[model samples]
Target: MNTQIKGRTISLRLVRKEDAKFIYSLRNNKEYNQHLSQASGTVKDQELWINEYKNRENKGAEYYFIIERLDNEKRIGTLRLYDFIGNKESFCWGSWILNQDKTRSSAIESAMLVYEFAFKELHFASCHFDVRKKNINVIKFHKKFGAEITNETNLDLFFQLTKTSYGDFFTRNNKFIEN
Candidate 1:
């Protein structure tokens, strides 16, 4: 797996120990975490979580990344590709969090980077992720990517997207970010 993925306005690189603080902050920030499961851990606990995840990440069971602004080089978000499924050709995507100040357009570019990395770089056939039913904004955002709601649980809705759909989304919308 590639360690770094660059888009027109953002970059995604492997998460490091130093990111524990940022991860802790993002995971605990109400604006970003309220719709998701709460992360209950101290910074030391977060560091250990990073170490444990490092091994799993290296084995390709998961990919964790820190998102940074390309122009100013400011770290603004986090992302992950995990939960490898049947045939291992599809995976769940989550851990998407960005600082509020940078969400205007960088959010789109950041997600595009992950999609490009998964469908193009890793040759993954599709990707799936769950969003809380109440997170309407994010649900709408996923729909913009041609993701279809494939399932629903009491508290969450699952969206799935094939590589072809992702490709066509950008092609039709004319929003393809430079690789």
Candidate 2:
């Protein structure tokens, strides 16, 4: 997989077909499914999904990335930007990050870096994320990144960050920090 974004201690890259096994293992972990878009099923089912995802050609519906720790080059998680809708001037985005216990924070940081790439490099007008209402920790983390709650239903809470807003956030949060 070619590296797409590299942070101080993490790397994000395109998911390859060879990664199906790794994805299979991680997706089966119950903890990883808590906030996932879909539930895990049999191994055959997971494999089928991975194959379809690997073969999918529609740029309009999905984009996937694998998150790895730089120190050991370990595949710890995956992130996806989905439901693309709009013109060149504007688009909507959503993502997911999943990892085992020890690498959870790194996964989150990698996700933030990917989001930076999405808004800054890709020139997306806005990015959004939806979380299950029960995932309080993730909700808090999104708040720390300056995401605001825009809508809530019985099942989910939606958060959004416009390019203008995220630019200010990136500046303020890194003003004194050195890589």
- Model 2 per-residue lDDT tens digits across residues 55-137: 55244345677878777888877777665557534444444555653353574566567567677666678777688899888
Alpha carbon lDDT of each predicted model: 0.86, 0.68
TM-score on alpha carbons, each prediction? 0.94, 0.81
What local lDDT does model 1 show for residue 46?
A: 94
On lDDT, the candidate that comes out on top is 1
Tell me the tens digit of each residue's lDDT in model 1 across 63-120.
Answer: 9999988788789999888998877579888988889657467878888887888887
Runs off by more than 4 Å, candidate 1: 173-176
Cα RMSD, each candidate: 1.5, 3.1
